[model samples]
Target: MSDVRTPTALPTTTIGPADEPATVGAIGYGAMSIAGTYGAIADADVTAVLDASIEAGANLIDTANVYGDGRSEQLLGRYLAGRRDDVVLASKVGIVNGGGIGKRGIRGDRAYIHEQIDLSLGRLGTDHLDLYYQHRVDPNIPIEETVGALAELVTAGKIRRIGLSEATGDELRRAHAVHPIAAIQSEWSIVSRDIETYVVPTAAELGVTVVAFSPLSRGLFTDSFGPEDVHLGGTRANFPRFQPEHLGANLELAAHFRSLAHRLGTTSEALAIAWVHDRAEQLGARVVSIPGTRSVAHLHANFEALQLELSDETRAEIDGYAARVSGPRASDPNWVSGGREGLI
Candidate 1:
């Protein structure tokens, strides 16, 4: 029984050079929940959540080919069957799972490329995808080869725009050279601010908008975690970032964020998102936050974060917290994504 807030009038927000309208209502639907990231959810329940997200002013929906072994796209497609045109649907490919072979990696071969798109389309029940991304780099494939193939898809009217995820600045530049990238989706939460080094700058230079995922530090910055909280669950249990031994130090850093967020009269989630939103804008770039959630209530909470602004002091406090965080912010050692990239 998830609570869904009704869509209220969204404040006028500007979009960046290659991005969509900055504010498309509040909150966006994250299809990963439907794929059972933390726990299993009935397909009907996922549909209800999707529709609930729409009712809550969520027009942007995020999903991937790997999510639920492609179930998210299928379910989302089935869920949005009649109203596909009403939403901005985003799906990603790459990360080829070679029939459970350790050969699992990315594939951009023209034949494979076309095949994956067809599969995603069939699953999503859409003629074209609004945004399509390469989920990960195929150490076996060249960026030029991959982006070139994707560019052809755009010309064929199969996709509206192109984006890259978990990519380095060099990787992004290479992709953008082949085609004008619309967005660059990545994990850019307060804890995963590694992108501030080059991804943000490259996006600004290339007229690409940054779509930030995990804007809440994978729930660490929410009201739940504290200096004393340490039990980790899900696959994160194996991650060094969430290891019980390191929990105390990480919690201490999160406290700094909590204090600053409180002073600003906003949730840490709100403060974190606002920092990215405002900073990107100040740099003459547009940014969007797409925090994923299982409950529509959480979605609404994430969306409302955009309404809260951080003053200079609050922003500075957040930077201070970032500096104090212990260990890598992302689920570390599980995978290497082009080095300091992705939702760390």
Candidate 2:
């Protein structure tokens, strides 16, 4: 039987582009999980998650154009028909997923940027996105040119705010100079701390909110699934950290963390997310964590994390254990573009 807990009210946080400010629940929903990335997810299940999120007071709904070929946004659009005003809608572009196999590419050109935003708006069934992000940094184009095009969209009201996903500190600075970068999306968790060295500091210094995706480290931190559950047909099977050789070591570390959580009388998943909240507080930076899950029960569990408060001593212990985690966050170095990786 699945372990289910009582739902708790989640607190709200503010994250917006440059001068614009918008408030959303502390824990946002990452819609990609229901787009069949890991496996087939029924539309009913997707709706349930969305409905549960709204009921739980989670108003930040994030999706991307590449997710299931834009099906993710369409699902949200359908669920958000009358309730659009209740949530902060966010989506991304720049990663082109159409054309023949292998035709996929990242584009930041002015024409491509202009074209994608309209298509995304159509899919999302919204006139203007609360926040729009570049799914990946297009190395071929200059950051200034990309941001310039994005700025045009902001002026035209196609998107209220601009965000960058997987952007390096230098790239973020350049993009911000072109136009105020409202937020930067990157993969950050106890097991994945690569962004802390530079991206976190830079975003903090610039007063840009860091939207930390995959705050549960793609489910490893939750202890709900083990290495044996990762099969060839699954999305996580392609991840290096979930591979046979690395899985054992990673699970061992997770087990240790889970034990610590048990001692604190909370679930591992809650503790893992609370660690992220704690880290953001320590940095004095605005951060929003979007942990994806297709199950309503899991969604409830995730929100419960917002109610947890970790002591300095416990935080240090978790950090020390995380330092010993095995394997790279991403198996493919090419996927680690713009200094962000482990994104789902």
Candidate 3:
């Protein structure tokens, strides 16, 4: 493990139980990349990133069972051995990855959810998850049945709060009716604003915190990203936005966004996160951003965005970039919540 370089603590935010809420760091750590979602990561680097996140007060660690086929959770389990209580642990179920192109599916049936929770708990080495999400909505299973299973976990003390990832406004509403949803995790960044059309408004009305994942557009808003980065490995290479035809146009737009960040005396990645925080406030919704990184320096940099304040004008300018992007948010719209908007 590497030593922590910066130890600045992030500000706090509240996530709901409706009956009682829990306070957690405003900026959380998303463990996807550490498990090779972006590319292969060394065990040492993963340890350092996890260590740095907790040291800097970004203790809200989020992961999913499908991430590296549960390798991410196992690594976190090792790290949380003696100090699990010090962190706000969250993980998700659903979305089985078959390890090839177009070989995945979502399952939210009671039996599957029940089986996965135990596996998640065993791998995480924790008896309970602070927040558990339905990684993706299962088209075959009704949202009500899925949420009902999660509600049972809450009763069993396996999960403290319920969350739905990439769920549409209607899906969120239906799930919330079955049981109070503490948060809705989705991709909400400079380029992905479709959620603002309906999901954000619904979450705001229900008083559910919007946990913004990929707030930096999965590195598109960062300095290191480029058209050639697609070959570096992981699933991002297959995303439509990074494909040959759309990459150039998106890169040009990112250049302008990066220039704006440079003028503001901040990294494009940090500025992108600040934009999410600012926009959430403007939309009358509470948000916590979980930006994943394999580097400790990047971890510290991500949490530093908590102190950033963006002006109304600047936020709108950043918001404008969303319109010019060239591809759909996902290769298959059906894979994300926006695609399943009207369906159950």
Candidate 4:
């Protein structure tokens, strides 16, 4: 039997500009999985998870326009029809389907950002998003121009605050100069710490919140995960860490991490969350981790991490394990900030 606990409110953290900071739950709900990123989930299950998350005070809902090509936002639109005020709604622009079949790329031009914001608003059924993000930085476009467009949205009442996903230290600095960046979304789990070297310190210096995505390394740290799970299909199939060549070695590292969690009397998922939280404190950065799930039990279980504190020895061991994990964070490192910044 699963150890299910009663849902409780997540502690709050402030995001956005200093004068107009918006308070949101520290543990936000990532809506990527429901977009069939993992697999096809029933509409009813999706509704259940969203309802449960918001009810538990995990009201900072994060989604992207490219997620299922707006299917995810449409689902959230229906769910938010009557409950719009309850969530600190967030969505992204920039990353979209490219010219060719199955091709994907970034689009951060002024006209494109303007067009995408309205489309996202229509899909979300909201006049304005509490927080908006550039899903990925466009190498062809200047970060200043992208942020300038977002700043116009803030002035036009289309978005209250702006954020950037997978942005480098330099990009964040450049973007913030044009407009105060509220948050930065990046992959920051025990297994993916590439952002810590430069992006984190820059964000801390600028007072931008670190919104950690895939904090569990896309279920790699979970108890039920196995090599067979990735073979079943979805985005994980495209991830290098889950490929046959690296799967065994990564799983071995995961096993050792799981054993540590067991000794601490907690699930690996919970410990992973706690580690991100601990790392944030250690680095003097405000962080909010958005871990996605189709199961309400898993969501509640994730909140358990808020109460789990790691000792210095445990944190050091986890870092050691992270260092030994084989493979890059993704198949196309260029698609991520760490890669663009030459970290990977």
Candidate 4 residue pairs in backbone clash: none
Determine which window of 10 residues in candidate 3 has minimal summed lDDT: 1-10
TM-score, structure 1 vs. true: 0.84
Instruction: Give the per-residue lDDT of model 3 (tens digit) for 167-211.
Output: 999999999999999999999988888888889999999999999
| lDDT, each prediction | 0.69, 0.82, 0.86, 0.89
lDDT by residue (255-297, candidate 4, tens digit) is: 9888988888888999999899889999999999999998998
How many pairs of residues collide in each model?
Answer: 1, 1, 0, 0
Worst 10 residues of 1 by lDDT: 1-10
By lDDT rank, best first, the candidates go 4, 3, 2, 1
Model 4 lDDT at residue 251: 92
Highest lDDT scorer: 4
* Model with the higher TM-score, candidate 2 or 3: 3
Backbone-clash count (model 4):
0
Candidate 3 segments whose C-alpha is farther than 4 A from its true place: 1-9, 342-344
lDDT of 3 at 7: 38
Sorted by TM-score (best first), the order is: 4, 3, 2, 1
- Residue 169 deviation, candidate 2, in Å? 1.3
Q: Please list the residue runs of candidate 2 whose C-alpha ends up more than 4 Å from where it truly belongs after superposition.
A: 1-8, 17-19, 98-104, 337-344
- lDDT string, candidate 1, 133-172, tens digits: 8877666788788888888898999987887877787788
RMSD (Å) of each candidate, 1 decimal:
5.1, 4.0, 4.3, 3.0
